[model samples]
Target chain A: MNIRIENLTKSYGDQKAVDSISFEVKTGEVLGFLGPNGAGKSTTMKMITHYLNIDAGNITIDGRSVRNTDMKKHIGYLPEHNPLYEDMPVIDYLRFVAELQGVDAVKLDDRVKDMVRLCGLNDEKHKKINELSKGYRQRVGLAQAMIHDPEILILDEPTTGLDPNQIVEIRELIRTLGNSKTVILSTHILPEVEATCDRILIINKGKIVADGTAETLRKTASGSQVLRVKIQAPSQDEVKESVSQLAGVALVEKVEGSENRLEIQSHVDQNVNEAIFRLCVDKNWVLTEMVPFETKLEDIFRDLTMN
Target chain B: MKTSNATWIIAKRELSAFFNSLVAYILLISFLGFTGFFTWLSGNGDVFFRKQADLKVFFMIANWTLFFFIPAVTMRLLAEEKRSGTIELLLTKNVSDRQMVLGKYLSAFLMVLIALAFTIPYYLSVSQLGNFDHGATLSGYLGLILLSSAYIGIGLFASSLTNNQIVAFLLALLLGICFQFIFGVLANGSTGWISELFNTLSLTSHFDSISRGVIDSKDVVYFLSITFLGIFLSEYIISKRK
Candidate 1:
């Protein structure tokens, strides 16, 4: 199902937990929610699930307002911290969630079996949730959220406590599910967004700061490019001076305590790679290494979220 | 899911949770032990002392035991869910706030029913000794069930108001004491409209009338309204986040 949120606002006493923020998630897309702690990502997801009422504006699922319709049946939610009934066995908990989601009696058993297989909980199905490891418990949380095969999945930090292999497996699973369902997952892992999400939304202080694919967000983050080069020249000072004088090269400085390394920063919309290569060849200096530094998502996130 | 179906599903899970933990067994054993002692073994209200075939002493002891027991059953219903953040998971399902409240209320009510069911042996033993007032005894059991419902309702309301089980228990008992005895005591000590109002509000007066084979609609309505108000207030508090 498609989700459209418009001018949604919420407050706690004098503080606005979620301002008039708006966004949309299309069907068959995975949107990664990125924000620092207390950035309102969870608040927005809660509002989408209708767990929290929108103080202002509204959310619509496939053109129907959530306030006017019981959209919960169509949306599967994994709350933050992934709370589960620790006293119940994993299988029983999954069945209970499926029943609460209104899975039909005739197919409930089949659905529960499917979730067990899908979430890789077959070995631990009979054990109580609290007896399992944190990674296994996380899998149980994911299993219950998808037990009824909901059209939309809203997961708050889905891979918080998983190992590397499990994280990769879950990302693959989410990617597969995204082909036929709308998935909105929030996380502190920067690479997880690029690995799983079709779009990235960065919100800060209850407002949206950036929205687009990872590539587009990086492209808009900065106007200039930086490159580090190691040249076998007579002197580091000579290399820095020559690189600084080259056209399109805005700044050049000798690498701190390095004998032959220099950092070159290019002007906006400029390419200094070819110019540096030619200068090296002309001056009889051997260019041993040159690496272009692309803007990292971490830097972009920090730049956008940090004041 | 249908409204009632969601409610039942939640209630079923809660019921199973109660059984899977030690709480249910502890409550049953203690409740039976306490009531069993005072009804047949105690010197004051024992069947031998009363010299009556009816279970009046049993009913009176049950009223007091259940007043304390219902809160224990209900204190963890909402408070634990809030503390562990499971309330968010449950509420986000295809269940409405009213369904959630009613489902929890049903679980505690069923618990009280189960506890009461275990006392049937005491009734059976008393009846075998002599001719029992079956009409009055039956109404007395009905009155106990209705009174337990009112206490469970109030207990659930108290549970919904906070995330601590201890606080919920204390608050439920505090609220329950007013109806259990304070109002009745005040009515006896006062006069005029104040006494009349306290008398009407006191739960013991209605329970007494029903246990005596006086099945008045006024008494039934009184118990039903208190239960409804408690359940209604719980729903209102839970949905207040909206």
Candidate 2:
């Protein structure tokens, strides 16, 4: 269930909702799609699932074009907003999805029951979807998406309205599901990607700005490493001057609170901790604390998208 | 699964949804109440006073009632699906666009048939009243079914045009009125090919011919063609929106 999207483009009237962007997700790999609102994440997922027409380019699943109906049989899609029949009971809705997915008649009931168990809907199986809480409704959406045991699952903002506990539950469920299926989940929650995805693609204004593992994206977007040092030094200017003269130190600034504290910026590939300690020893400054600052995913996301 | 099987599965789910809600009961009761009140309780040619064995009065009232009632059954078919965003889930299934349209069309059509079936008591009671024209009564029922089918098609097409149920209802009613009476009125005042064309397109003319106990293929074709055209247009609209 490999997905290959090549130069895909979609336009609504004069506005291009999805520009010519391309990526691939191999089987058993979890690809996280990260973007702000209206960043074309859902549009891309829709095109891959064949729910929307590919306007300018092509998408293929396992080397076959998605235009073929057979390609849809292997792909499961939970669209944005996670729409379900409000009047239908959870079990009935799952069964209906299974039937539509072309599950064999002999295995249909078992498959639906498995989804109910997997999605933790056993307690609410008989309740109408409208009666359930938002979190349970999301569970039902996920259950229906996997009823036929599809090889690929495309979920858009799957955990949008869930509470904290529900989010963790679903996060674990997605991680487990990713063990054997190719999953492309889109969300604004960065930690969800760090927790579940093997790779992350950050799209901004219909273009891929960053694609890599979480660590790589952090390093790439950060451009440099920061080191925070607190010591019993002589003065702010003296510490700044000594730290700035280090080989890999790019910039040095005084910490506002105390004259003894200095913030050091170094080259991207440099680890200034050892060099700073030696400088401190040479300057006879008793270094109380030296900590390297790692850029948070939130900062990276903001830096990538805000500009 | 086969496309037909998928269609049936979708149709069954739709029918179940209809029955589970209050809309179906409200529609059935109101439709029967209106038909019953008009046929036996109101109007100059009431069944009891007219003393006619035929159900011409019943058919006439039914023809008008369905013009409004059929839209109620169909207005939410596609419109609500679109509003609720379930149309995305439905289209992503292994189901084809045509299958999805037909599935919804059949469910609404079946509800109409059930409403029509409730009038059997009227038929039976009328049969016992006098020497009834059974052939004409049968033809009348056939005509109603065909006419209902045509209206259902139009209603489905209207539902696809917008996500607002009220708008869908009004659009279907507008189209139904045009085919049911406006065209006939225009035909009566015109002459030559224009009149003939309007006359042929009018639903009432074909319905009248079928109600006269003559099942002409041309009349049947006319009704079938309109029904097909409506469903076909709905399918096209759904695909285009995709």
Model 2 alpha-carbon miss at residue B235, Å:
1.0
Residue-level lDDT tens digits of model 1 in B82-167: 89999999989988889999999999988888999999998888889898888999999999999999999899999999999999
Instruction: Kindly report which residue pairs in candidate 2 clash with one another.
Output: none
Pick the TM-score winner.
1
Write down the RMSD of candidate 1 (Cα, Å): 1.4
| Model 2 docking tier (incorrect/acceptable/medium/high) | high
Best by lDDT: 1
| Candidate 1 Cα misplacement greater than 4 A, ranges | none
- What lDDT tens digits, residue by residue, belong to model 2 across residues A240-270? 7878888999998877877577788998788
Candidate 1 TM-score, C-alpha based: 0.98
Q: What is the interface RMSD of each candidate, in Å?
A: 1.1, 1.0
DockQ value of candidate 2: 0.85
Candidate 1: tens digits of C-alpha lDDT, residues A76-163: 8999999999899998998899888889889999999999999999999999999999999999999989988999999999999999
User: Any runs in candidate 2 off by more than 4 Å, and if so which?
Assistant: A234-236
